[model samples]
Target: MNLTIQFYTMLSMIGMGAWVGAALDTYHRFLQRPRRKRWIVFLHDIFFWTVQALIVFYVLLRVNEAELRFYVFIALLCGFAAYQSLLKKLYTACLEAIIQFCVRTYQFFAMLIRNLLIKPIIYLAQALLALFLFLLHMLKIIFLGIYKVLFKLLWMLWKLLFIPLGFLGHLLWKLVPQRAKIFIARYAGFLKQITKVKGIILKWWNAIRTRLGGPRE
Candidate 1:
């Protein structure tokens, strides 16, 4: 029974060493080697060795009641040598392939989600923007049409008023005294100046409206 326990203990240590070797190889391939910072690499090395030492110590305690033996150390070295010589290449290749497959799968799903969800949302936003612009253009055309009709009516009313005013001015010019005539002339000049100012104000107003994306005259 004592000999059997010793053999089993050796086998367990050997298996543990093989597993540790594989874990170290995987860590080096994926995490340790790609690091650019010396401090980060050092921290990782320290953490890896610490965790491995704790696991070996636990195994030794469980198997041999925490007794230190030369043969136990030898068994661990032999197992690590076996893994390096026989299994290292195959295990590393399989681990790399598995990692690549997972990365490809994640990228594929991400692209699929972008196409199904994000692309459609962008297209919908563009369509809404186009529709809004079209509606704004139609509103501008309607407002311009109303402005044109109102301007035409006002112009016609001004012409109708001018006809009677012209006749009255002619009669007053013939009948009025010189002083009265001079007063009427001054009043007519003032009216002309007022009309000029009105024209200037209308021009400025139209320019402002046009700049604001409203209809132009």
Candidate 2:
């Protein structure tokens, strides 16, 4: 009975070791090297070793009353060696195929969502923008037309007022006293000085523009 129990324990330990090997391979392939996070990698290592230790301890406890024996270690090593030699390639290939399938499935769904949902929203926004621009352009044209009409009316009013005012001023000038005529002459001289200064500034501005290769205004 004792021999039978030991034999079964060895078998169980071997199976457990194969499972551990497969788990480590999966981690290396999918999680360990691919992820660059230190804390996460530490956690994965800790969890993997902790679970393996617990499993080992439990199996030992059941089979050999938790006795630490050289044969138990040997059995585990043999199992791991067998897995590496016979099963590693097949398991890795299957794992890679599964990963590829999952990636393809995700991409298909993403493309579907972009076509069905995102594309329509983008098109609707563009149409609304075009409509807004058209309305703005129409409003600008209407306002410009109204401004031109108002400006023409105001210019006509200014011209009508200026002609009457000019005639009144001439009549007043003829009726003024001699002393008042002298004051008006002084004011007229000041106006001529201002016009002379304005002409000089315009001449200098045109020279600067020509030197800078700017078109004459």
Candidate 3:
């Protein structure tokens, strides 16, 4: 409307145009269009253009009440042209350098954490596990050795007593009445028969349960 407003609007549009160019470069740099699906690229393009348009319109609203005169377009084009000719190469180079720095920083921190924290913890855990296994193995061997020694001593003691005890029992049995021996032998046979009958019944029950697909105790 007035000279001051018009001048301000032109300057704002020029700055907006340069900003848009820079934003476009950044977007495309990250978008990786060749790797993106068609639908995704399409959506991203629509959103990007919409946002840029809205930004330009909002700037215009602030500068000159959203007025659209012919000079605004000329000024925007000039600013974009100036960025392309003068600033594109410098900005791109700086951006690449910054990206490399960031990647190096991330890699350094990751390596530091792995070496300082993770590796030591893993080694300590492995050491504890190894020590535990070693102690368990030693305990097993010690118990087994003690068991073997006890078994041998008990076997020797039993052998040392058995012959004399057996001879004494034979002499005592000879002194016993024949009728009493006969009664004990018959009762022992009866008990053996009962045990055999129990075993057979249990076998039959287990077989029946198996055939019926029932769980066994």
Q: Which predicted model would earn the best TM-score?
A: 3
| Clash-forming residue pairs, model 1 | none
| Candidate 2 lDDT, 35-142, residue by residue in tens | 568888888889979998898899878877877767778888888888899998998999999999999999999999999999999999999999999999999999
What lDDT score is found at residue 63 in candidate 1? Answer: 82
On lDDT, the leading prediction is 3
Between the candidate structures 2 and 3, which one is better when assessed by lDDT? 3
What does the lDDT read for residue 90 in candidate 3?
92
lDDT by residue (tens digit), candidate 1, 72-185? 888888889999999999999999999999999999999999999999999999999999999999999999889877766765686699789989999877887999878767
Over 1-217, each residue of candidate 3 has an lDDT whose tens digit, in order, gives 9899999998999888888888889899889999999999999999999999999999999999998999999989988888898999998888888889999999999999999999999999999999999999999999977976675576468668978998999999899898999887879978899989989987886675565454453
Query: For candidate 3, what is the TM-score?
Result: 0.77
Candidate 3 structure lDDT: 0.88
Candidate 1: where are CA atoms >4 Å away?
1-5, 32-35, 177-217
| Model 3 regions more than 4 Å off | 174-217
The best-first sequence of candidates by TM-score reads 3, 1, 2
Better by lDDT, candidate 2 or 1? 1
RMSD of 1: 4.7
